[model samples]
Target: MVIISTENYEKIVEFCSKFKGLTIHCERQLHKKFSDIDSQVLSAILSKEWQKHIKQRHHIILKSSRIYLQEYKAQARLKGDPFILLQIAIRENFSPVSLCRILLSVEFEGKPKSVTNEMIRNPHQIPDPLLAANVLNCLLNDKSDGPITDLKRQTIGEDYEIRLKKLASDAGLNFHDEVYLRRKGYDKTPDLKLAVPCMFRGKIINWIESKASFGDMASHQQYIKDQLLSYGNRFGSGIIIYWFGYLDQIGRCPENKDCIIVTDDFPKKDELVLINNPFGPLLSSNISNITNLL
Candidate 1:
């Protein structure tokens, strides 16, 4: 069956005529009427047809929402953190152009511990809280994270120490990935640093720091802030820290306005505010859980 319907057909015509050099294809079936346009006129018109098809698909999947949720759920299984799935959901809605800007303004509140237990009970429910807060934050600022991945220079120990000490030296902040830092000399730290909003290269966030129980690290809270502040931008004022688990423990950083800790460790009934970012609010969560993730 033809995916584009008569209702949206005119819109297709307008788009094709507006943009030059476009192509359209249907995976399911061939369009007998498509041949009527001829090769020369077909380019722009077909492109618009493809655009319409994609838009229609985006709306349909988003409308169902379940498909989106399922996509995230599967992603969570791989990441081992369900909340990461929520993060992924947010990413899906972003347009090609606004992605980087969206990534910059995004900062996530860590999940509470109780949330893990809650997931065990009813994993099917949409993580509306995370989605709401993230969406709101995205709208207000425009930004978006996960495991530690890589590094440029310095040893793990030296790199991590530099990152930690550097962040401490600054207002206090750091963000590091696992393989990247651990390889040099740095140990796996649970608390990702948010010392500075901007990085050394003049990038906003520097590293994704993490800490675990086994490793020898500095003071728990103070150390965390030190690492975070160090990573803060040497230029601008936006320095943020994201703690994956335990909200009350981290409470507020030296600059609560700049720091955020998200954990699913809270009571299911607890009221947590979800902030809407530019992309959309709790949209990914709804879509992932309700449609794709299922």
Candidate 2:
């Protein structure tokens, strides 16, 4: 549950920036390079910093397509990472379905177009050949406008959310997770909303949010605008867990108003105040009726 301060966080981010463009396979190299940081923490920081670079690079790619296209194609040929090509294609003019069709055609040296074209939108099964996997992975991965990076990050985020829910459950906490709350028509729901609010460390905690990435300055501010503020207004004070750690300075952001406590992990049993008296199923049914502060 380490809470990194502002100054240390900036230094960590700066150190991690050197690893931009490094792929997932570079974990071992990163571990040797970043001896001072935990492997998991280093990975998260590198992910944030690399993503920033990728975003900026993508913008430049769009603006200077004539120059970047040649560079991208060369990189794609040198490395099996076709995402470079896929991303540029998407950024250029192709919608996802169109991109799939184009890549499958003989123009791109793909399998018979008819065979692969049917499965444009995956999860809606079509006769997809095993041969199509590489291209499909690139096309799907490029949907987020990056090359093979975000899919891994998305998986990590889901894994952390599962871990958070498990820890909360093991501690005898009862709550409706984000999916359940969403189905019930709640807007701006946090990862876990306690069925019954509990006092923890002298503050009432109504909800909890899990962030799989490090909380850098920009990302934290964006979350405040898109999520934290709404969660605060609707659900009252809650906790935000930046699993890798966040800028210490973000906690003091004026908009935060001390309502959100940032932490690196789920609170321990000792840190949390479990309700001695269980409210049971009726509590859930009761809370479901309230429009705010649930």
Candidate 3:
């Protein structure tokens, strides 16, 4: 994940907002236009912008489906591109398959789900051959709610967790991962917790968290309230990895007053100064002396 300056990030976000009606095909054009940005980072930024477009225009989409649907359909029919029409009107990247549900719900006299299933599982079974043809073309390109899109996100997230854990292991650090901590009846564990604390950028880091998305201010704040602060309180200190990237001003948030260090990826082995215990030399000497006497 590349660290983007706040000004530039906002500019990219503003640029992306115009692409609400388009799909990732537009993202490809954007990459060529903004070649300096990492493609993955740009995609991550586009993903966030798309989500915002969807949320902000959700009520509008619903309204168009209910009130202005006939007008939208007339325009879609006139233009021969229902998707583009709905997209322009509602400001969302929509699937014709999902749009079929919205259309069938009204047109078929309360019989949408059955046709929706056909559109999904057996498009050939859909009665209208023209619609079936349209569906066949759009279904493969539909990244909005398709399984392929969701699975890629899930796989990326799982893979990053594995990378974080492996990095901890390669550093000769012993740590309990979330699975083990969960089994041990602990709640709110990070991705990994060190057996012995390690110094990272002068702070003793006790745990690590891995995230697969760009950390915008809203999502970052939610994570701080939900996970980061909890991990710090339970484990003393920790690092949160936003593998894709984050807002530049994220480091100055009030929640950062605690020991949660934000990073884009796992640090190399040398970056972490492994410590047997975080206690000072006096405490270590006293423990050694006590053990010797015993």
Candidate 4:
């Protein structure tokens, strides 16, 4: 979830600039390369003669009495198919799936939680909290011949701890700060320390740890309150976020309940902060022109 550094950004730009014709690296493999992606995606990224290519293709199709590419694209969309569009973006090199996943992970507004490797092995069945955590962990801990990856342990148990620490640091949010894990006479200290500006003038605001679901809050309020009390605040806040990926549905922490649920949509109750999505509205508008933007 770390923000892309200028150095990394430059590297990516340089990589894109040098891309060969009609070729791309597949997302599932760092080393595998393929040439059969959407011509549009490839054209968008690597071809300087995209318009000429399109025009010549159109001319050939017209001479042969075949469907025009632009017309075909419109037809496919009208037929309720996103596969073509997705393929084009993926193939033509608009952006790699890895980069998109990285961007989403970077912008995520919730705390990183630990999930089992079994859950990661079968993400389709797990909860969002666990799934997201595992996905972020894998991305952050990906094995490349890089300085950070070289230092990480190979075993899942050791790697989990290492990855979690890295994930917290990447998120710019403390995950284990002031928290401790005690097992058989060994106590492991937290990696992250929650630091938010003091609220109510002088009182330092402590945060509560709880699940990211709206349903979990009503059931788990006492446990969260207890965590808050372990620190020093009767008025501590819990940062709540919805586990569902929907951009329109908002979640909330109860009013005056020493908590704050952060979501993209406004909460029905008080004591929540609504984070804005830069692409949500645009996507909605594109999907349906009737959606009111005003």
**Top TM-score hit:** 3
Between candidates 1 and 4, name the one with more favorable TM-score: 4
Per-residue lDDT of model 3, residues 1-294, tens digit only: 478889888888888866644555767877987899788888888877776765675565566675545755465467665244335333445544455445545555566566665555555876755455555555556555444567788999999888887778887788888899899998788888877666677667778889999888888899999988887776676788888888887877777776788889888766776545464443354444323322
Models 1 onward score TM values of: 0.19, 0.67, 0.79, 0.22
Residue 88 displacement in candidate 4 (angstroms): 52
Error of 1 at 112 (Å): 47
lDDT of 4 by residue, 234-269 (tens): 323434322221112123334324344333211222
Q: What lDDT score goes with residue 18 in model 2?
A: 53
Error of 3 at 160 (Å): 1.2
| lDDT of candidate model 1 versus the reference | 0.33
RMSD of each: 25.0, 7.9, 5.0, 22.1
Deviating ranges (above 4 Å) for candidate 4: 1-167, 178-192, 195-217, 220-235, 241-259, 262-294
Window of ten residues with lowest summed lDDT in model 4? 241-250
Give per-residue CA lDDT, model 1, range 1-294, as digits (tens).
012233344443554434322122221112344553223223323432444444544554445455545554465456545244334434453221122122222221255544433332232332545433433332333211111111111233344445544544443233343444456565433333332232221223323443311111113355446554443332122222221122233333344234323222221211211112234343334433323211
lDDT-sorted candidate list, best first: 3, 2, 1, 4
- How many residue pairs clash per model? 102, 2, 0, 5
Q: What is the lDDT of candidate 3?
A: 0.69
In model 3, where is the ten-residue run with the lowest total lDDT? 285-294
